[model samples]
Target: MKIRKQLPISALIAASALISTQAMAEVFVAPFGGYSFGASDFSITDEKTDELGSLKISESNHYGFMAGVTTKDPGDIYFLYSHQGTELRSGGSFSPNVITDLNVDYFHLGGSLYFPNGNLKPYVTASLGLTQMRPGDNYSTESRFSMGFGAGIEYQMTEAFSLFADARGYATFVNSSSALFCDGGDCLWSISSDIMWQGQANLGVKLKF
Candidate 1:
């Protein structure tokens, strides 16, 4: 279930109004939790290419933290970390005991372009990071290169607090590899490293000091 998602363009146009403006430089921290949806599917088949069965990960939730500074022109440079876990369900009649826990963790550095001074601020964000994926117990973690971008708005609620919402999608470059459930030299299915994506609609709070 790989769905290619395009970055929202409407918000990019809205945020362009701040290009010529100036903003403040300050430190802030935001801790957020939100619902997340997984879109990665693993299928099993005979080595000769016969479709045997498949598995899909279920929707899950995520929580993370960002801490960084607001610089001139109101841009933000932040460090981020997040965790998500999903359950693998049978998509076809593979193996009943093949159901397992799938987990992903992200460690990234992000930057955003924003308007300096406004009750309602629009911004665009892009980040480059590392993603760690765990398929099941006793298996080595898979590390991959990941990147994401999106746009959103933040409304100042007080001198030190603000509310924000954004929609973004991330792609993990998994490439192609042998399955973790393979037996001996004969594997059931070969996984493609194409693009494993997850889309997020998040609501959170930012505290500026």
Candidate 2:
């Protein structure tokens, strides 16, 4: 992929230097668990030709995990990791009682630049990582991968700890399809991977070292 002039090489280098220096201060690792709610949808495009179809799915009420490192001061840079997942049940006859499980697993290796002087430390964090979604049943499953980014705020209690929350979204790219069911003669039904989008709201605590 070619990076445009808007994302200059100099800016990239500068950000790298910043993170390197920030890492030296003090690093604290915290394991956080939270609940997530979202939704999912699906659609089918070409009935013939490629037997191609699309799925639009949005679901919520799931669980998530986050692990990160924080600095000693209220306003400093820190790195973090996060994850979320859930399951959906299809309704009636066609419903197939099919369970649609969407799991978002993210390995984020990024830093947060916080504003400590304010009543609440408002920070902007950007992460470049891999996101995977798994839609499956008791016997079969399918998965996809994509990149993710996040930004939010953190409120400090003491210099060593605080409460924080953030809203993060992920865009995924995966090729999906339904299995072909045949009754000894003809093809019954088929489904295909269209495209999917996922968004999440995270609430947790930041304990500084």
Candidate 3:
């Protein structure tokens, strides 16, 4: 998949807040769907993929929702939940003849700051929470602490409706000292525990309360 990383922190936060009233706005909800891009290959097990081999995960689409409070100062404090997955491919001459699957579920406490314009809003977001990775079949699952950030723009359609688009990245941290899988006296690193990161492009509709 062809994907470009977009990392931008608004340089005009102070300059753009001249129109704020500092009053609290009502609650809001944003439901979104988008395409997910997987990070570069990494070993699930302790063994370095360069020495052993690599597992390639196919980029797939994901969907999620956010519930938050939008303030007149142009900020959002929201809870976000997203579902993501990919197909697993191992790099080797003799590949395993098994169908493997990979999935991730994210639960985050996220926040955003927007350069609020009359009808066009540009924003940046950050979040930290839990990431759960499930490898298909009987493989043990991996769950770890994760963090992510994003930037986007929103265009208001009416007093209570808006459309927005954003690009974001989430990373899961799971490290091991030694391989978790052992075979006859030889141990392979854990397949369920590894550092993983994912990027996404999303478009969603927001409803104001």
Candidate 4:
């Protein structure tokens, strides 16, 4: 009878310890704004004339937010959503000269590996996600698989807040089909490349809860 009573008490203590350890894990959200550049240029060709042209996505500002939970390791797993509004310009007689209103968005699931020292932590991050490209007017939106890799440093200001900056490079796989950016049988552009690339630099504040 005493052993049965002691077993219940022991189980209660074990459960309490597990809960306390979980409670010590940190949850954080970071809202960030950044400049994105180095978007790859696509080659365009006139099917009948055999003339070559070029298409470019302009450099622009992007914003995003990340929410994550710290693991037992000195790292965290996060979900990131970022968006950029820019222009697509055409050169060498590929028809429309410029699409002034274009948007690029990324939805990513990523993780960071951290090296901590005092109040500062330097980390490397990698993510895989989808990239959505939307152009204004009659153009259709295109979604492609993408990945990113980056490195950054964070300075902890207090127990609940920190500042961070990161530079990341993204690679988006272009569709193999010719139907991209098309609406109602009219196509805005087509390219032969398998991948498009871009780079970004971000600064943000991390809030912990």
C-alpha RMSD of each candidate structure in angstroms: 13.2, 10.3, 13.1, 2.5
lDDT winner: 4
- Give candidate 4 misplaced runs (Cα > 4 Å): 1-17, 46-50, 92-97
Q: Rate residue 3 of model 4 by lDDT.
A: 100
Could you give the candidate ranking by lDDT, starting with the highest?
4, 3, 1, 2
lDDT of 1: 0.75
Worst 10 residues of 3 by lDDT: 1-10
Instruction: Enumerate clash totals for all models, in the order shown.
Output: 2, 19, 4, 0
Alpha carbon lDDT of each predicted model: 0.75, 0.54, 0.76, 0.88
1-209 in candidate 3: lDDT tens per residue?
12322223233454355434333566899999999886656555334442454556578888999998886557888999998776766654326333477787899998999997789999999999998867775555657899999999999999889999999998878664544324444554544435677888999999988
Decoy 1 TM-score against native: 0.75
Stretches off by above 4 angstroms in model 3 are: 1-23, 44-51, 92-99, 178-188, 191-194
For residue 163, what is the lDDT in candidate 1? 91
lDDT, model 3: 0.76
Instruction: Please write out the lDDT profile of model 2 over residues 1-209, one tens digit for every residue.
Output: 36676478879899998997676565454555554444445443333444433333445444444445555443344344555555644432234343455555665556667776565877766665565554444323334455555667777677677777777666655455544222344333344544455676777776656
Sort every candidate by TM-score, greatest first: 4, 3, 1, 2
Clashing pairs in 3: 45-189, 46-189, 179-189, 180-190
TM-score comparison, 1 vs 2, better candidate:
1
Candidate 1 backbone clash number? 2
| Model 2 weakest 10-residue run by lDDT | 180-189
Residues 46-163 of candidate 1 have per-residue lDDT tens digits of 4566657665667789888889988775678999887888766666666544466878788889999986456999899999999887767544566889997878899999979999
Q: lDDT tens digits, residues 1-209, model 4?
A: 99999999999999999998798789999999999999987776544465777777889999999999987778899999999999988766666577557899999999999999999999999999999999888778889999999999999999999999999999999864554567666664557767889999999999999
